[model samples]
Target: MTEILEPENCFCQLASGSKGNALYVKGGETAVLFDCGLSGRELERRMAERDLDPTTLSAVVVSHEHTDHVGGAGVICRRFGIPLYITEATRTGSTKKLGKTKAMDIQAMECGKRFSVGSLEIHPFSISHDAADTSGFRVTASSGAVLGIATDLGIAGHLVKEHLSGCHALVLESNHDPELLYANPNYPWPLKQRVRSRVGHLSNEEAATLLDAIDRSRLSHLVLAHLSEENNTPDLALAAAYGVLNGSNTSITVAKQNLPTPVLSF
Candidate 1:
């Protein structure tokens, strides 16, 4: 008798090392990319190391048009003719920077809509941020496992919390510590105020508070992401989130700036 192999649920941080963020999720043969924040060569090298073939990617879902988030998007899209998905507002903004491509290749999804990319179901929720049409996503794998991707958000909103409530894994933001940002010498007063506002980035406290609001019973993995290079340290972010976890069974890790995190299995 022939034996059947079980498929594993895996998520890899391709560029979660520093200011930039990108992730790859695989459920059996169906692979979906979360963000393309690195250069094409770097992304290629990293994927190769993981034994992933770029042509096998199902689709690319973008969160926003920040250069760090979309740097390698154009290259990958054109290279494989992959479907690029985002909101209409984000698509418009992307065109302003990326220029017109094959319109047929762009899949425009409305906020709060649930859609499928291969075997994965994606739910895009609106987030408060300075960018136009910023969003976070919840992905449901074929195995019924759920993963939430949220970063570069200002404060957690009703939608974000509701969608993120029951995920098995979450890539949540821990952008900066309030004290570190306020004490930074490089930022001007206006920029400092912007960072502190509800429409700007989430502070470590805000990230922790968001976690506090969630139901932690089923929370398996929580990765602190999109940390500020100048204003935040991994130790501080870890400490704050650890305090929030308060000795819960949930596991936590600080996504590093230069090294890709191992594919976390659920």
Candidate 2:
């Protein structure tokens, strides 16, 4: 049987939020999924809405073992017969969450190592997050287009800034607003503390500060993702990032929890 390939140098945010997070990236004939947080059914539906065919996916690469990042991984791999890539620690920690499922190919990846999926080269780097062995990726296509992704991390440090330096597009986290998160009465004290910790998610201000440290000379598109539904609004996140990127030619968009962003191509 022959398989049709997806378009070259394209990226899309299937879903992004505290609710779930998934991203689709295709370079040449190879298509890879960054995370599968949505249920299998929901993920499939959203991909279809974007005219993407799951069967064409080359692999499902995981950033961490958190439920919001790995919940739908098992089902998606089982259904599409695609390989699942993650660090050994993440695989071990997520065993219970991933559950038992039909046999599928699993590949262990190491942080700071570069790997290839068809014509796309992926470099995974360690990130600071609560999950075991969380990673941020820099994917460069055969066409020389680079897409850098750094979500679920509390801070974007020197390593992250270095990897994301020359990206053409970026999907960065703007998880919350400190003021809104602190004022939200629904969240308990410990939860708030965790969110504000060094290993927790990045607030809007933190994300903007990280952007300030990075080189955006070649950056054309920036998508703010993994927003907190309770403490962050699209307008707020957009404003923070827009403030930092005011002089650049980069196009900005805030990813939605319930919808997929438009397919961005380079």
Candidate 3:
């Protein structure tokens, strides 16, 4: 007798960091991207390397209007002929930043609304971030597996905790280490203050606090994303999350700045 494996849901972190961000998620017949912070060429290359077809992508979803979150949105949508799902304010605020590209299909997504793209159902929720209309997502696959992604958020509040609870997998931001960030002489006082503010990135402690509050019984995978290159390291971020998730069945991984992570299947 031979062992067999099942074809499960696929999730890949194509890139993550202050410099860029992109994610690829597929369930059933639907393939979607959460963000396209990388260049169009880089995103395509990474997807190809991961054996994912760009033509099969159902849509490109935007989380906010930040350059690191929407840098490649316009180009990727135009190239793949896929619709760009984003808030009206995000589109309006990002027009000049996303640059002048050919017209592409745009779908307006409001906070707290549910929308479907192929075999996945996405629920967008407002998050506290310095953007036109920042959002976090709770995506459910046709198979009932759920993935929660909340990055670039200053704080993981009640709403974020509510949406992220009971997820099969989570990609959360652990952007900085408070001690390291505060000690770094390179960063000015005001810049440091902003990074620690309510509308700034989450510290390692903050991310861990959020994890402590969320339901982890159903979680199989935990990915720490959007780490600050200058203020954090993979080992530090991993330790912070491990402190909260140690001795659990869940597997943890860190999303890096320069490359895509191995595809995680549920």
Candidate 4:
């Protein structure tokens, strides 16, 4: 056996769903906010609940311009004196949601480009989503630990698998169950169609199918995220994933929309 030195990468979903989304990822001395969909005050409260310090954040990286992903991006960056990392298209699309932000504090990041934030290296890849230039992030710690995040994406194709492959931990979306989504009386026909569209969200079965395509031999942590409160249940999401990951030695969790998941390390 060999001794390892560098710290393992760790992450937690502060909140995830249609209402809001946010996550914190840390690798060694580097810590970053992957999204800040909640208000600055609420995001800080969630961090506090998890014993994480917002002052230590290196940057706030946005995945897209959607309100559920970028609503609090500007406030969090400003409050913590951290830089805001976003693609140019996303920056333009988020103008209103991000509110006022210092031009100098914003760093432009293109999809498929790699960027550094302290000891962590981030690779952003494009994803199928309705938002402007949505991305799925692959974060690698200096020690070679990898954390993959691919939530809020509609289609998980070869590219998604390529980016998600070999991850130690993954936060993937399992948005809804087709039966429930289709049967919901509150949702109109158009809304149902949109929910299952190519650029909408992943159903539980679709998530399971996508998981089967990705490499999970070394995967230790898997969190199913962005579940619909109205259309899906944690049990349904977990059941779908369990079928694909049957008897696998992996810790699976269903992320909540309002509460933070416990910190998961790789």
Candidate 5:
């Protein structure tokens, strides 16, 4: 009989905020990065800290064209010469902002199709947002472990809920609290309404409610991502999910805008 090493699959947030966002996923010797929002230098520094080399990264996937998500995409693609993957809508918007130089490397992805990269199966599912075309993803590793990544949705519909069920780990958005948004002194009325709109961002309560509806039996790690700087706080987001998660056996962590949380192994 031979002792077998369990397959290693992990996800880590490189950055998440109004400024920029990225998530790095690795399994075995094959690794795929989901987004590249931070600058190439910053991305290099983070990768080095994790003992990862950017040149060895398999591919870079884009969620949408928002500056916070695609700001550093071009830089990463250019620096490493990695193929950039995105939907046609995302490519159009990215082209306008990131320019033709970066857009040249983009490989368009079908929103509902599941594609393969090394040993990881990448599925890009549609997510409701103000952007032209945005998606959440489910990456199934060769070891049979699944990781669900979703963010920047105004509401999680049947499509979103059904796709996210029974995942080993998740990076879900808990962007803001409704009350906090209303009382916040900075945002004007129109901007505030947009933030609370169905096409805008999800409130902390919404995120919590979605978690409650999810089948948590197989859930190991749940990370609350994309908090608003002015309108949300970690304590409040934690409190929103605390009640539902109190008796449930699951580990919850908050993803900071500035600091990287420890890589979660699945």
Candidate 6:
């Protein structure tokens, strides 16, 4: 189903964080969930909240094997009979994690290769995350609108920056504030190290640096996602972003942990 008469970036972060994560991005004739991190029921409710119908989805693309990214993939695929796209390594790693599903089409994809799902052209790139294999996506809609989604990643290296550059919109990871993370008494030293590792989430500074490095001159929309509830606050995250993007026209929205952000059109 076409969302608009003209080609535009139709996007939303259904949910974002450790508890769960999901995102919706639509093209004129094709719609997809970048990650279905919630249960089937919860996913349905959120979609309903956004006025999105599951029947319209062409596929549920899996970025990695992490529960926060792949939890609802199986159930949604089974219930709706939507196609599933994932790398072979990611599919294998998610076996036990993503429950069971009916006999559905499982498409294999690899980093550096580009594929299309109806109206969206997608390019998957390697991302540094502690998964069997994690992918960051750069998607272009039929309208020629480009969107870059890179979350659940540790470091934003040269490859990631190259892939994400010159997008009309981006959903990036601004996972935590380093000071809060280090000082949080509830987290053990080992857990902190893991979170601070090159394979872990991005801190506010790291996220800002990546933003500054990327070619955001053409970027109109920015959604900061996968924030840590225990160690990060919206104010802190926004502060870092605002500092770098000062005097810029790019709209910034920090994704929420409990609710979905309003539908964003670019």
* Tens-place lDDT digits, model 6, residues 85-183: 999999999887767644777888899999999989999999999998899999998878899999988899999999889999999999999999999
- Candidate 1 matches the true fold with a TM-score of 0.92
Model 4, 1-266: lDDT tens digits are 77533235788899999899999999998999998899989998998888788998999999999899999999888777889999999999999888776543999999998999999999999999888899999999999999999997888989999999889999999999999999999999999998899898999999999989989988999999999999999999999999999898889999998899998887
RMSD of each: 2.9, 2.8, 2.4, 3.4, 3.3, 2.3
Clashes of each: 4, 0, 0, 0, 0, 0
- CA RMSD (A), model 1: 2.9
Per-residue alpha-carbon lDDT of candidate 2 for residues 1-266, written as tens digits (9 for 90 to 100) = 78744457899999998788899999988999999999999998999998898888999999999888999998888888888898999999888767664486889899999999888899999989988899999999999999999998877789999998989999999999989999999999999989988789999989999999988999999999999999999899999998899988999989999999999975
Each candidate's TM vs. the true structure?
0.92, 0.96, 0.95, 0.96, 0.94, 0.96
lDDT of 1 by residue, 1-266 (tens): 77533247778777763356688887766788887878778888887776667888888888888777776777777777788887888877777545446643888887788999878888899998888899898888888998988887778988888988988998998989888888999989899899888778888888989998987777888888888888999899988899888778788877776777766865
Candidate 6 residue pairs that clash: none
Better of 4 and 5 by lDDT: 4
Give lDDT per model, in order.
Answer: 0.81, 0.90, 0.90, 0.91, 0.84, 0.90
Tens-digit lDDT track of model 3 for 67-120: 999999988888878899999999898897666544788899999999999889
Lowest summed lDDT across 10 adjacent residues in model 2 is found at 95-104
lDDT tens digits, residue span 82-103, model 5? 7888898888878856655634
Model 5 alpha-carbon miss at residue 223, Å: 1.0
Candidate 3 segments whose C-alpha is farther than 4 A from its true place: 1-6, 100-102
lDDT of 2 at 112: 91
- State the local distance difference test value for candidate 2: 0.90
> Which residue segments of model 2 deviate by more than 4 Å?
1-7
Pick the winner on lDDT between candidates 5 and 6: 6
